[model samples]
Target chain A: MPVISYIDAVTQALQEEMQRDEKVFVLGEDVGVRGGVFRATDGLYKEFGAERVIDTPLTESAIAGVAIGASVYGMRPVAEMQFADFIMPAYNQIVSEAAKMRYRSNNTWYCPLVIRAPYGGGVHGALYHSQSVEKLFAGVPGLKIVMPSTPYDVKGLLKSAIRDEDPVLFLEHKRCYRLIKGEVPTEDYTVPIGEAEVKREGDDVTVISYGLTLHFALKAAEELEKEGISVHVLDLRTIIPLDKEAILEATVKTGKVLIVHEDNLTGGFGGEVSALISENAFFELDAPIRRLAGPDVPAMPYSPPLEKEFMLNPEKVKTAIRELAEF
Target chain B: MGSEESVMETSRHEALGLSDDQVLEMYRTMLLARKIDERMWLLNRAGKIPFVISCQGQEATQVGAAFALDREKDWLCPYYRDLGMMLVFGQTAKDQMLSAFARAEEPNSAGRQMPGHYGDKRFRVISGSSPVTTQLLHAVGVALAGKMEKKDFVSLTSFGEGSSNQGDFHEGLNFAGVHNLPVIFMCENNKYAISVPIEKQLAGGSVAARGQGYGMPGISVDGNDPLEVYEAVRDAAARARKGEGPTLIEATAYRLVPHSSDDDDRTYREMGEVEEARKKDSLVQFKKYLEDVGILSTESGAELEREIGHIVDEATEYAEQAPYPDPSETYTHVYAE
Candidate 1:
């Protein structure tokens, strides 16, 4: 095992997949010559040349459409969105064409493509670059959404997403790219999708989170453990087809639930998770369900104070967990 | 003497080397499309079919462009009004009826898509969605694959005059132009996109002229003249095979009927206007041309119509009696095995 940054894991996954399958290619703005805006695709162009490592124009719809067309023709295309917020122009391609390709064609077709987009708040991305787009695409059928919080998980999930038979939206948290570093195994492996991983085990309450907020839940659990208030932190690696069994098992064991996420409260993935938990594990509840998430604001502002106020942290998670456990 | 002018004057189809039988076959496909559509509208009014999208006045453009391509090699991404194109591209009369009836045997979509949403792997006709211009990009992708695999084929995608205003259209063409892919973007400008006329739909004038911005040759052809459309598409396909970029073709026609059975045309256009356009219907004009050129006589025309009537009748009977899909199959295709 070697310690690597979150961004390196994504690059490693892309390299490994392209090497493993000759049909796989990469395309996005600055993905070739400039090595991507975040350098997540660094040096792929030099190794694969122009055909495999394509640097596309700034049109997101065209980029998405081209990838879809290629994927439909038996080519595995890994498209980059530059920024998650910029995916709106390509929304039609993803929702109407890519997501519905397999269904509309009635099993005669498949859009087995991967779309990697760096998303999250913090680092002053402000409004446009800081959006978390999982909520927008989670409702779509024939599509998969994955958000990894650590380097090891990101590497495994990216590799898995590329090989999946359906269109996968691999949302990489921008803040985690450099900040989150962990040991990634040198040997090839993939973390299965639709499975939740428990980062910490506890008996008092089950604290569910994912992406950046999963770290907060873990930190809160660690701090609570010192005071004998045990907390179980579960990271939902995939949003769609969510790990229902894991969620039910955790809720059954803890009897108290608290959900944490960076996205706004309304219509977030957490809302769906909470709904699933309540419906499946209603009888095991010890307290009313609580959520520690971003406020229902439009977006994070550039101002540090306003952003800080809007962001969730370990303190907030710890407080929510303590209150849920006590109740 | 004008050097460019030839002493011999002939119909455009004759000049394009269309044999009498082939032209008649094209005419037959167009007539079949119109007849089937007429039947669908009747079925809708009689509360038999759920919807009706007629190919009424634009049959010539559909048949002509489809005839220009190599059906076995080339790919087609047709719009909702391409009944004639689907027929020419190997989709049988029964196959269409199965779709119109939305029966389980519908190969285009397996009873999933609407009637005119064409797709068939056997004939290389790529699948399409309800969205107006996404198929344009899909066609480009087909051409891209053709280029990548070094196949001697092109992809033709058709849309209405109104859909040319979509971002997908622009993006699709821009991509095709940049890649120099073997693609022919045929814009079937049937005057009205629902209710908006061509004048209101495009402020920049001709859809063909916009091809210049994307670094491709743009052409405007008479969609009512099957010969003219065939020549335009034939030349464009040649250019694509020669490693030249895509060509934008604006085939002008008229939507003689309302947008769909659900629409009423009176609020948007006067009946007199529609009647005037109907006078230029290719169905009537092409038949008269064939008669004048001595290619088809009154007896032959009647004979062809009777043959088409029989085919449409048998297909209608088969489709109406076809089985509907089971409820359990609805969840089947959402994911792969």
Candidate 2:
């Protein structure tokens, strides 16, 4: 087993998928010669050449729209959005075109597209670069939103997304790109798209989170264990087509739940999770379901103190966990 | 010289390499599109169908451009007003009626989308949406795939002059020109987009001339003449097949009817203007051409109209009697099963 960073896991998945299937190609700004801004597609351009690793002009809609067209033509295309914040220009393409391709065509056509966008807060990337854009697309039916927290999950889920028959929005937490490291096997294996993983098992409280915040929950769970508080941590690997069974089991096990995310709290994905838990496992609750997330401000500010106030760290997760457990 | 010019004008289709039968077929297709569109308007007025977007005056442009491409290999990403193109690409009158009726057998969307949202895998037509210019990028993507797979197929997409101002139109054409992809961007300049006239819609006053900015040749032709449109598209397809890249074509015509069934033209434009444009209708002009070429006599023209009338009548009856999709089917095809 070889330990790799989350970004390395991404590069490995692209390399393996492109090698295994000739139909799989990569396209986005600077994805070719420059290898991508984060270098997530590093060295893929040199190996696959320009035809497969296309460096497109700086137009998000075209990147998404063109990939959709090629996907309908029976090619698997992985399009990069440069940053998740820039994905708004391609919003219509994703929602109206790619998402509705199968339904509108009545199964006569489908878009096998993977739109990889680096998203999250915590870096000094201010308003434009650092943002959680998952909630914007979570409500869309035909799209599969996957945000992996670990290097292993990143590799497996990306491979699975590429092989999936429909459109998948693979969001990579930019902070976790190099920060998270884990062992990834070289063999071809996939972490199924719509499954949740219980990273730790305990009975006192349950913490549900994903992406970089999932790591925070795990760390908080470990620290809480020494304080005689047993916390169960569940990583929601896929947001849409949520693991209802896992969510119910995790919620029922501890009866106290705290959903954590870096996105704004008002209309975040946490609302959906809270609804699911309340609707299904309300009777089993020992305490009111609590949510720990960023404030409902428009975005993360540029100042470090303000940014820290908006970001969720391990200490915050630990406090949220302890408060729910004591209640 | 005057006699020589008259001789050339009489045999224009022959000079363009169109055999007598092919020109006759073009005339038939144009007439079929007109009759079907007219029937849809009547159905809409009768409260049978919900909406109708016509291809009334632009039939010549659609049929001509469609005939230039290899129907079996090339892909079409057409906009709403492309009934004529759909006909030439293998979509039958029944297919159009099924869509108009929003029936379960509708090949375009199975009653999911409204009529005029054309798409069918069997015809190699890429599905389109209500957005103005999104299909341009889709066509470019299809051409990109053709180039990548070493296939010699070209992709053609059409839109209104109003759509040329859309960012997608710029983005699609720029991408296609940059890669030298085998795609054709055809702009059916129908003088108005909904209610906005071309002068208000286009800043430069010409959609075809904008092609130079994207490194492609832009050509404008008479939209009422099928032979002219055919010649332009044929040359453009040849350029695309030779890997010479895309071409921008502007077929100038008038929208003889209002934008849709819901729109009332009297409020926006005068009847005199529409009646003037109707005089240059492609069906009338093309029939005279066929008559001059000694192909279609007055009796034959009447016979052709009767033949098309029967097809439209049969299609309408079949679609009207077709079943609606089961409610359970609404959940299917959102994703792969």
Give TM-scores for every candidate, taking all chains together and pairing residue i with residue i.
0.97, 0.99
Residue pairs in clash, model 2: none
Model 1, range A1-327, lDDT digits (tens) per residue?
799999999999999999999888898899999999999999999999987888776789988888888788788889999999999999999999999988888788778899999998887889888888898999999889999999999999999999999999999999889989999999999999889898888899999889999998988899999888999888898887589899888888799999888888998888898898788788899887888888899988889998888888889888998888778
lDDT of 1 by residue, B1-337 (tens): 4424653666556779898888988888899999988888888898888987878999999999999998878888889999989989888889978998999999988999988887887887767888889888888876776777678798899999999999999999998988898999999999998999988999788999999999999999999988899999999999999988799999999999999989998989999989999899999998987887678899999999999889989999999999999988788888777
Q: Report the error of model 2 at residue A288, Å.
A: 0.9
On the 0 to 100 scale, the lDDT of residue A215 in model 1 is 90
lDDT of 1 at B80: 93
Global CA lDDT of candidate 1, please? 0.89
Q: What tens-digit string does per-residue lDDT give for candidate 2 at B39-104?
A: 999999999999999999999999999998898899999999999999999999999999999999
- Cα miss at B326, model 1 (Å)? 1.2
